[model samples]
Target: MTCMQLLLYSYPYVTRFDLRRLMGQKIKLTKSTIDKLPIPQMGARVDYFDTDCKGFGIRVSSNSRRFFVLKRVKGKLTRVMLKPYGVITPEQARVEANKAISKLYDGIDINAEKAKDNLKGMTLADALKKYFETKTLKPRTVENYGDLFRLYLDDWLHKPISGITKEMVATRHLNISNQNRKAAANNVMRTLRAVYNFANELHDDTLPPNPVKRLSNTGQWNKIERRQTVIPAKQLPQVFQAIQKLENPVIRDYILLLLFTGARRREMACLRWESVDLEAKIFTLMVTKNGKPLILPMSNFIYDIFNKRKALRENDYVFPGHGKTEHLIDSRKQVNAITQITAVEFTLHDLRRTFASNISGTVVGGYELKRLLNHSFGNDDVTAGYVIHSIEKLRIIMQEATDHLLMLCTAGKKINE
Candidate 1:
């Protein structure tokens, strides 16, 4: 038997010193000693300890040799790699080993200390960049977050996230609210809260509690009511007449489609020809705000609009634009023009509200209305889960609603004539 094997057999409970001696010769680990050490066989390693410094050693393996420091940390022996043999001289390794041993004796966790340092150094901008990298947010949501930071938190970008205090958050919220941008203030705080919470979770909870929580605790958050604006049914004809006179055919059709389908502006604006079915008399939205695809039966008016757009199709988009997206974006100028001419003040979303308000009780049931709007039933509405409204049924309801709207428009046109 080999001498090392016999020694292992004799001493069942071998100490690290005994193991080190069995593995390699005990010597002062100078550059000369490290260079003279024999490399172990393939798949084997030999650890040579320095007699001059306790727990300082050089590990020789088939591949390479590296310097390391060994210490008992929290009752467990831990070996921390310092540098490869050629990367640092023997004197440099000794200096690093001494520092490492000192830290271990002081009960300082090197890894934990580094993590804390990183957390402390992270700025709001850095946190935001990391948040975007780690999250799977929709493009529009990402863009909106960027816009919020630029508009509201631009000054705070370079500020360390850990340094932001509860008092600072409260003061900022109050100041933004006083500027009459109550909704913007709430949105900014919410965005900051999301980013801070994400960072706190990411850094092993080493960060302080989110400062944005201060707004809620101190009742400093703005109380902005949801807008309930919608076009009065009587004014539908005026709005329609003004929309028809729009010079830009694309914008004119886009606004009409929004009113006809009760679709969000972006949803209708970004429609593709592939999603529209001329024969089926239906249109489908593959990407809706709720993340669910919507297939809605087109009313006669909506079908006609799509047919007209099909004839004028210049690209894949139903309403093609000259921009990078190759789809219609905003039509605020045209909408504002209609509002001015008809004296009917309304936003694009207001048309969506108008469509729902006009047709809710008269044309469809509660669940049917919700389905038409592509809204989630939510967990609270258990009965809604059981209720399934088919496309044909929805088509009938849509037709009835479209007929009513057309009747109003016709009446308004006759009055104007």
Candidate 2:
């Protein structure tokens, strides 16, 4: 008998084996061959990272690591890896594997994906967020824009951009006018036009056209009555004397710079030390209402103020706040205090208007004035329209205006003995 025949009679698990028979001769079995045969045993349990299974399985070992794999009743294979001896207990692995197997039996796949549907709409709030991201506006400007949006357009923020019509915009104008008749309607119209254009760009051809183009208004409702806070042009000397009387060096220099340069209140208030170029004698307008970078050559008066500021400059801000890192954010209260004590009724903002008005009468034209004051230049339909203005002409006009202010300041000064 062959080795298979000998083992088959003794072994219970052996079922069948094929062997060639010699012609009319019986095959002989080797005892050593039959004794050397080994058989596989029943399946073992698996425990890995809270994984547990029971079936005909595999015991896998790699680099001192051990794991188990088994076929489930659903004709799918599952793996239960034994946690490293110390890092995680085999008991934890067994628990996790049992949970996974239960989920598999229930036909729930955690990795399965379901289709989702989302709505699309261009809204005022969405437009505002985009504006904040792309627009290079001054900090105060950004703050003011947020304020206007909150105070005036909070309800409209949720309204779809496409739904806003020219009629609605006109109605908003009338509404704002009734509340503050003296408000600058031109500014409101301009802001609205800009916002619509912004929304149009963002909508990417979805918005048919800018609706503000269809709207028309004379912008007469925005007329603001000018406040007479400045001393008469002839009495500029008295104003200079009043400024010099202020004891605080920061306040004194700030006031002098304002009067000399004719920069807006917040421009002076928020001016950083880096923005000032002592060598070039220019203050670069990186942030302005008009959103343009302007280089303003310093006048002698402004240069002197810068000299004084440099001597006392302890912080990065030209006008340092008390125990704060940035410049003095609000000088309105201080300006108000000075006006009250001096019996002057004009606000700090009025000073800017005064500067523009006072300089307009001289050789300074509209464009030069706009560049200096950072005012927006309008086209054919707007007042204070300026075009094709260059900095060279502005430099000359600014230098003359500053010199005039400086002469006024020094005329009444006491001679040091």
For model 1, how does the per-residue alpha-carbon lDDT over 1-417 read when each residue is reduced to its tens digit? 665664454444776476556665668988887887765556566677889999999887778899998888889888878889899998999999999999999888876676677878899999999999999998999999999998988899999888889988888888888899999889989999999998898778878888998887778877878899998878887888888889998999898888877899888877899998899998888769988989999988888888889999989999999999999987889988987898988899998998898888987788988998899888998899899888999999999988877777767344347
Candidate 1: deviation at residue 13, Å?
43
Error of 2 at 24 (Å): 59
Measured by lDDT, the strongest candidate is: 1
Task: Give per-model TM-scores.
Answer: 0.79, 0.53
The residue ranges of model 2 lying beyond 4 angstroms of the native Cα positions read 1-120, 131-142, 162-171, 181-193, 197-230, 275-285, 288-301, 322-325, 349-403, 406-417
Per TM-score, the best of the predicted structures is: 1
Count steric clashes of candidate 2: 14
